[model samples]
Target: MNLKEIKLAPFIKLIFIIAIIAYVVLNTDIMGFVSKGISPVLTAFIIAYILDYVVRFFELKMKVPRSLSILISILLFLLILTTIGLFIVPRVVGAVSSLIKAIGNFEFDINALSQLDFDNFYLNEIQQAIVDTVTPLIQKLTNATGTAVLIVVNEVQKITSGLISLVISFAISIYMLGEKRDLLARIKRTLFAYLSDQTANQVLYASRMANKIFKAFFLGKLLDSTIIGVLAYLVFTIFNFEYALLIALIIGLTNMIPYFGPFIGAVPAAVITLIANPSSPIDVVWILICILAIQQLDSLVIGPFILGDSVGVSAFWIIVAVTVGGATFGIVGMFMGVPVLVLLKTLIEEDVEKRLAFQGYEGFQSNDIKNKKSRK
Candidate 1:
């Protein structure tokens, strides 16, 4: 090759490499492939991570043996899982059966509407418009009942697979936890072997921050959801709502999704009530009231207390994260999106502060401003 052609070869090769990577990412199921490949490792990491906290509490505070601590933690975890299963499974099955039986049989009747006399022309016109809207909405709801039932069944099937995966993951995690110190030492050695001290420290710092954010967010959410779920159960029992256990479980679980969680949980309960007791539309109204009351308490009181500054993202960004995460990874994505956003926000803020400090800027960091105000 000529001198100029030889000089351009590296640039051409770099472009080709970039094009190939982009094409593979765009055209292939790269995410699915990666998820399938790393799922076991990821699952193990999560289990070990959670168990570490419990194991540490036992070993450190309770002065239990490390091995004994691990065993205790696992047993406690299993006990909680079993208790929840016993409480939730039977009710969920019964609710599903009732829903299936009630579907396709539900009818909408507003016969009393015809007897209403609206003397004002504008009021009459508005009444007619509302009736017209309700007619089609009811028809659509009727048609969707079967689909809803199938969706619940499909969700259960996913749960079954998830449980199997969980078992395998926990098995791996037990081993990891048993070898925690060795594993951590090995990981640190590997990082330092290949990465410079500064880079290794940066990576470790980022990982620690991410872990802290995730743990805090998840624990807070779990407590919040549990409280909301209990409140829902109490309300349903007080009001004599059908499928109380099943509906309350739905509310509790979906409450993990954030922003849309309450409404999402409410929809199924409302739909089932409407279908099973067409004559008692007030029950649906009461259910809505219960949801609103619990959510208000959560948002104004419990949520703020438990999860304050955990996500760091504003409500709008949280909504966007939930939407994108749900679209990309379904329920798991929606659950994780907020904490991931928090980690990213923290990293960005720190990077910005570092850059500002490097540029000889003062009092630019958020903490600095807050400190100044507190001093005043």
Candidate 2:
């Protein structure tokens, strides 16, 4: 074989031995705990990042203790989350419920409309199509309403579970943040003890970049969704639509989808509008125009400004990431899929631009050109 493999038989044996041991460790019951515990670990990581910034600001700028600084940061983060949740979630829930309740009436109302033989057959067809499209949507909304009732009934237990996890995560984050310097010292010590400083630095740097990417992506998109939801609610109220709150909330929440988010959000919103006012042609047109206009504002301005700043992905690449994500994983997958791609893109770009730059590829471009000429 290869000269290097032939010469490094002992090293290869050691690697195999290590790999087998590690594999066993990672596949055992202990690994199940690790897998299940990933959520808290990540939760802690987010908390730590936010706390780290706050601690640095206070400790460096105000000459305060790390403990107080971390507490203040955690409180601030909690406050922000609570304020947004209070303002948005209830209104959204109410709107969704009202929309669900109104759908049955709207459907029955449409059946009555068929009695009139409205001047044009086209109008009749349009009304029938609208009813057909909305029927399934109404069913889905009803199902969601049932699920919401279940949640409300089990709210205590759910809240308890949520609180417990949140507490554990916060504690872990506090530990990490408070002892960040010491933790770094231990990591550096381990790396120097077992490996080289240069490799360790590279690993650490890559990890920081990955962490930053996740932080910016999740938080920035959350902000974007909140803005859109609130704006839609306001607009809907202004229009004096009966289910303004509900449809707007749905649009906002669903707006979290990447490239196709707007269309997904608009469907139910438009359907709700059309069904609710099938006779009022002008109202239906206006609702369509308004939903499209809001989506346009998001795609053109708000989305680009917020998500674009954090993810730093171009519109073209956003479409690519979203399309691949949707094709692979459906809706929920699409939500997380783009961020995963961005992380991978970041790593590949970094690796190529950094460590792999010196790897030889001298004739690759010219060889391709020569091959094309020969084929011609």
Cα lDDT tens digits for candidate 2, 1-376: 2222223354357546864765665657875777567878889987787667677888899988878888888788789879767986677667655654665445334456446666788998987787787567656754565565566667746878887898899889988998898998898788778878887786687677877887677767778888988798788789887678777777877888776887887777777786566566467667768878888898889877786556665557778878865764467456876676676666655444343334453333443332211331
Error of 1 at 332 (Å): 3.3
Q: How accurate locally, in lDDT, is each candidate? A: 0.81, 0.71
Clashes counted in candidate 1 amount to 0
Model 1 worst lDDT run, 10 consecutive residues: 367-376
Model 1: C-alpha RMSD to truth?
7.1
Query: What residue pairs clash in candidate 1, if any at all?
Result: none
- Pairs with backbone N, CA or C atoms under 3 Å apart (clashes), candidate 2: 95-246
Candidate 2, residue 286: the lDDT equals: 77
Report the poorest 10 consecutive residues by lDDT, candidate 2.
367-376
lDDT, residue 59, candidate 1: 99
Deviation in Å, model 1, residue 113 alpha carbon: 4.8
Off by over 4 Å in 1: 1-37, 110-133, 144-163, 327-329, 365-376
